[model samples]
Target chain A: MHTRTIEILVGLFLIAGVVAALALAINVSGLTGSNNGSYKVYAHFENIGGLTKKAEVTLAGVQIGTVTQISIDADLLVAKVEMEIFSEVNYLSIDSSVQILTAGLLGGKYIGLSVGAEDEVLVEGSIIEDSQSALVLEELIGKFLFDKVSE
Target chain B: MNISNKIMDGIASMGRGLLDNLAGLGRASMVLVHALFVWPQPKTSFSLVVKQLYNVGVKSLLIIVVSGLFIGMVLGLQGYTILVDFGSEQSVGQMVALSLVRELAPVVTALLFAGRAGSALTAEIGLMKATEQLASLEMIGVDPLRRIVAPRLWAGFISMPILSMIFAIVGVYGGALVSIEWLGVFSGSYWSVMQGAVDFYDDILNGVIKAVVFGFAITWIAVYQGLESVPTSEGISQSTTRTVVYSSLIILALDFVLTALMFGDV
Candidate 1:
């Protein structure tokens, strides 16, 4: 009876290990899949300090895709962001504008897109127009403090 | 001599003792590595390594799994509560995953394994020494360090990585289940949060390295204490206690060093 009990325990442990392994593999695959042939769009930002790779790009606060890569263009001195938008959200028009947004007053940065009602849909490699740069928290705080000093 | 002179003399003596111990430790480590490579015949030790892996890694799975689940759940609950105050419940997945992958899973699982298996190893080896089995092996020209200690060391190192991987996965699952299933977190946002939270190679490699270091410490301390045991039963018991205490301390110290080295400015 004791031997059987030990065997059962060992079996349960093995199952747990297998389940855990599968979960991790699934999560990893999910991340990799997020970078597939999902269409890319570029947004220029003056500052994107808290903005990171894989940060969600949301339409109406609903995630349409994620920021894949970010690089500063030396000539423009602007941060150019590459995003992967899902095929389902391909209805975004070429006149659509992108904004770097925050969840709240002290929240991580995300991309916000304002949909334009133009008949034309955005091409895969098009740049988002009417873009707003990231709202730097420290600069905003400094501005607020500076206003108080001047007043 | 004056009191100040006596104090200086004592300080000088302590410094010499520290240097002497360090030299001895350096030589001993070199010998241990040499013995590990040369003494164990691959033909015979292959099966031994497999058995030890099963005993060390597979055997401790349950405790690690259960502990990991609870740890994840706790992290989710606490993180949700704090994040919700700021109305950011969606970020709970990222917070939970980051904590589990980077810190909690590896350290907690290693400590748990050390408490369980490390104690058992110390006692088993101490008892064998008390019974003079080690001496008998020595008389027969059997290198006990290679045969017994090496297997335990290898077992511990392998077990730690396996257990850590288990812990990280289970913890993430537990967090996801609690937040998404129990609470009303959106499936879309939960996944989005997790995407930013985990890096495949970075997190896994960190966990594996921490586990390997932990395993080495546990087994090394256990075997060192066991080998130093006297024939008396009391001495054996004392050795076992010292082994567990020292191993636990070393594990914590090494965890800090490894974390700093792996992820700077921790």
Candidate 2:
């Protein structure tokens, strides 16, 4: 009887470890976005440079949302990115810049939000005005080569 | 003349000792093969395996978790210090996750298992031998090898991977705590960077395979030492010490080989 009790306890401990590992895996994978008190926003860019769905959206280094969708504009040949911004970050102005940025030198792409001096706060379903795409390494290299060749 | 004779004698004894140890290993392997393949009763082996699993895996949980956490914290702190100079502190997540999943988790988990459970198993078996319990079992026509050693060996094989997984997972969290909360990194960055950087097959699955291999080495060494140890108190102590030393050396060496094979091209 005593050994059986001990076995049960050990089994419970092992189960807890597994559950914690699973929870951590899910959290780190970013499967569940910032669903806590968030609203939608959108932006347009020339090139996203391998940005995928569910990329983080940050305002002043704080995560405020995620990129929910990416689509190409039919006429302007621009990438239209849809974002979900949490309502807690309500201080963003209508003219705030939305820029695609790499987290580190070779890290994943995310959205960086820069504040503007305008007084009117951004509303739901609004578009950020100043949008910047990621800097493409190949484009820069090609441009450098073209300049060098011309010279 | 006397001094030369002593030197010659010492060399001769050393050779004899080496031969004796090799012979012991041969006998132990025979026992292992029988224990593993020649199943007498499946129910008894299964129950014994569970008991050994509890002893080796569950009892060592606290130490594994604590060490895993500290290892991760150190990785985060040190990684940040180095990476911030390059303006890449954000990549600490990748550094920590990759380090833990690919190398530290399996290596550290096996080391701890050897030190704690491996040493204990060795001592326990050595004690049983010293007390002549094994002889008694043999006289009773019971195959002590199957009854005693096999389940423990199989248990270690199973436990090492699970423990290493838990270690890596816990270590990642420890890294996140330091990188995110203490260092003021974005929480999202801590996890997202890791998820993007680590591959399921290359980083995680390979780490698991390494864990299984380390487990087999450690357990086999411990059990072999215990069973073959000279039937004395000094012998038991010596075997226990040898188990720790040999298992650790084997774990580190195997890590290098596995890493070369798994990630040599990349």
Candidate 3:
């Protein structure tokens, strides 16, 4: 090839490579670039189990938000989860409930939200009133064995 | 010689060898520092860098893409077999994507770069030295390090991360092809789960960072070996071999350190 053609090819290669990197960042890795479309909501559970920050916060079966932070409510002795719900999902009633649920038999934990029937919808910084802690298998097994022994 | 005398001689030779290796390392590091810090003339350097990029990056693209595809497909197949037993066959996408983005793409691309481009660099520079071209350039008041080594080094450094990213992107698609198309996996869940699981900053960015580090080390080793080789055909061959061997070992060792620092819990 001519020197000019080779140089152009090289230039194209570099450009394509850079574009691929950007694609990986944006498309595959899901870099959304901003949090302006989301509002914060809080929920507290007695035990979160393996639920982690950034875990899916699903309404019905669709993901509507993510767990932004998890901390202890020192006074209440509960695990406080801060979620960023999409602003479009503004219909969650103040009485909406959240439950920690597993994806599969052996999968990550997520918070499933069940909307409530009420006139007052939850707003930014609203604390979900009804919440269920994650299921602990060992505790369930222990209870079952104890019940059987007692019987 | 007596037993003690022989033992003392062996100890003395071992110390001498250690000192020689340390001195060589110091020299190699100096070569890297100089190549990095010294600025070559831009008007000419840009063209030089482009040419070297073509030689190193463009030439190596086919191997990178092919290997990436096969590796991803293999991961998909293996992950499906394992996760299927657990009744989470849909997670094959997540497994393939995570493995490629977090570890395989960068590491494998770097290893291939060392073998394909790094050895070639060593041999090319060694040949130039053998033919007295470097010395001739020096005699003409040209800085050979700035003119020759710096551009090649920069080209290698730039090419590696780009190659690795392409590898990862292609690999993800390859995995998708196997899982969603051929294996009867739900396409939506396959992609959605992968997107949910792989974080840009934690997984993709860290992988890119690993690629960048590997590039810098591999190029530095290749150029240093070339520059330090004896000016003979056999010496050039030896330097090329050393470039591949040393680069591979350094890449693996540095990968462990980088992974620990980047991903390990304190």
Residue B222 CA displacement from its true place in model 3, Å: 1.5
| Residue B231 in model 1: lDDT | 62
Candidate with more favorable, higher DockQ: 1 or 2: 1
TM of chain B vs. native, candidate 1: 0.87
TM-score winner among the candidates? 3
- Model 1, A1-151: lDDT tens digits are 2545554554555566566655665683254544555788887888877899888889898888889899998899989999989987879988899888887666679999998889898878888767888777689999999999999
Show pairs that collide, candidate 3: none
Q: TM-score ranking from best to worst?
A: 3, 1, 2
lDDT of 2 by residue, A1-151 (tens): 3679667866876686577446545644434443668788889999999898778888787778778799998988899999988788898888899888887675678889998999998877898769998899999999999999999
How far does residue B161 in candidate 1 sit from its true spot (Å)? 1.3
lDDT of 2 by residue, B101-211 (tens): 899999999999999999999999999999999999999998788889988998899888888888898888899899899998777667767776776667777988999
Please, what are the lDDT tens digits per residue for candidate 1 over residues B107-183? 88878887788877877878888888877898999877777777877777666766887999888878888888888
DockQ versus reference, model 3: 0.52
**Candidate 2 chain B: 10-residue stretch with minimal lDDT:** B188-197
* Global lDDT of each candidate: 0.78, 0.86, 0.90
How high is each candidate's interface RMSD, in Å? 3.8, 3.1, 1.7
Q: Give per-residue lDDT, candidate 3, residue A116.
A: 88
Candidate DockQ values, in order, are: 0.26, 0.23, 0.52
In model 1, state the lDDT of residue A74.
Answer: 88
